[model samples]
Target: MLEFFNDTQTIHFIIIVGSMSLFFIGFYGIATQKNLVKILVSFDIMESALFLFFIGLHYKVGLVAPILDKHLKTFTNMVDPVPQAMILTTIVIGLAVLALGLSFGIEYYKLTGRNDISKMNELRD
Candidate 1:
């Protein structure tokens, strides 16, 4: 049992399960929440879950950064840089999107005095 718990496959499975759980929780929150801010938060939660999965998927045990140096000549156990770079880009874009969404939500609240999605009614005007 101790060996099983310490196995890399078991660890990977646990991380994958945890990430999936987070994604589902976020999905459920998005489906049930009426507040715009809560929905945005759910989206962020989902994004975080995706990041976790991506990072976990690319990670390798006993691996160093994929940087070229004089001492490290062989690329035998260097971590991939593509996923890390992609995640960084995604984080920047997600930040911009979240800012824009919050600003829109703020404007809507200012205009209508409410932030609930169900309460928004624009057709009657």
Candidate 2:
């Protein structure tokens, strides 16, 4: 039983399920919340779920980071670098988008003194 938990496949499954739950939680928050800030928080949560799933899916047991050293002369059993690189790039982009979204929210709040989506219909004009 202990060995089953120790297996990479089992760990991946757990991670997937956990992330999926988080995704649903985020979706619920986005769907039910009326506050703009809460919606943004939910969006972040959803983004985090995707990141968790991607990282978990790429993880392998007993694999080392993709770094070159004398002790690690071969690529065998080394973690793939592509996903890490892609995720790092994605994180930067995500931050930029989040910052832009927050700035928009701040501007909207400043202009109308409201942070609820229902009250921001004036934005259409």
Candidate 3:
């Protein structure tokens, strides 16, 4: 059992499965929840899952970080930094969007006295 857990392939598989499950959990929340705050949280969960999936899958057991140094001077044998950078940028953007969404939700709740998506009919003609 320990040996099974020690394999690199098994670790990668676990990461993939875990992230996918997390994404679906978030999707389920978005599909079924009626509260504005809950929906926004669900979206955030999905974003986190994607970040985990991207970063986890790109990692290798032996590859070094993509940093230049005297001993490690080449890009060879180093993990690709593109995915890490992209995920970092995505995380920043996601946080901004999440904050904006939550603020909007708060304002909506303040104006309407409710945050349920189905109850938001103030704009109906």
Instruction: Report the number of the highest-TM-score candidate.
Output: 2
Which portions of model 1 show Cα errors greater than 4 Å? 68-73
lDDT of 3 by residue, 1-125 (tens): 58888777988999999999999999999999998888988999999999999988888878888899899877898777999999989999988998999999889878879988988787899
- Report lDDT (Cα) of residue 82, candidate 1: 87
**Clash totals for all models, in order?**
0, 0, 0
The lDDT for every candidate, in the order shown, is 0.90, 0.89, 0.90
- Over 18-124, each residue of candidate 2 has an lDDT whose tens digit, in order, gives 99999999999999999888998999999899988888888889888888798878778888788788888998999899999999999989998988887667748
Question: Superposing every Cα of model 3 onto the true structure, what RMSD results?
Answer: 1.8
Ranking by TM-score: 2, 1, 3
Runs in model 3 deviating more than 4 A are 69-71
Query: By lDDT, is 2 or 3 better?
Result: 3
Error of 1 at 68 (Å): 5.0
What TM-score would each prediction reach against the true structure?
Answer: 0.88, 0.91, 0.88
Candidate 1 lDDT by residue in tens digits, 1-125: 57777666777898899999999999999999999999999999999999999988777656788887999898778778889999999999999999999999999999889988887779768
Full-model lDDT, candidate 1: 0.90
lDDT of model 3 at residue 16?
93
For model 1, give the 10-residue run with minimal summed lDDT. 1-10
Candidate 2 wrongly placed segments (more than 4 Å): 123-125
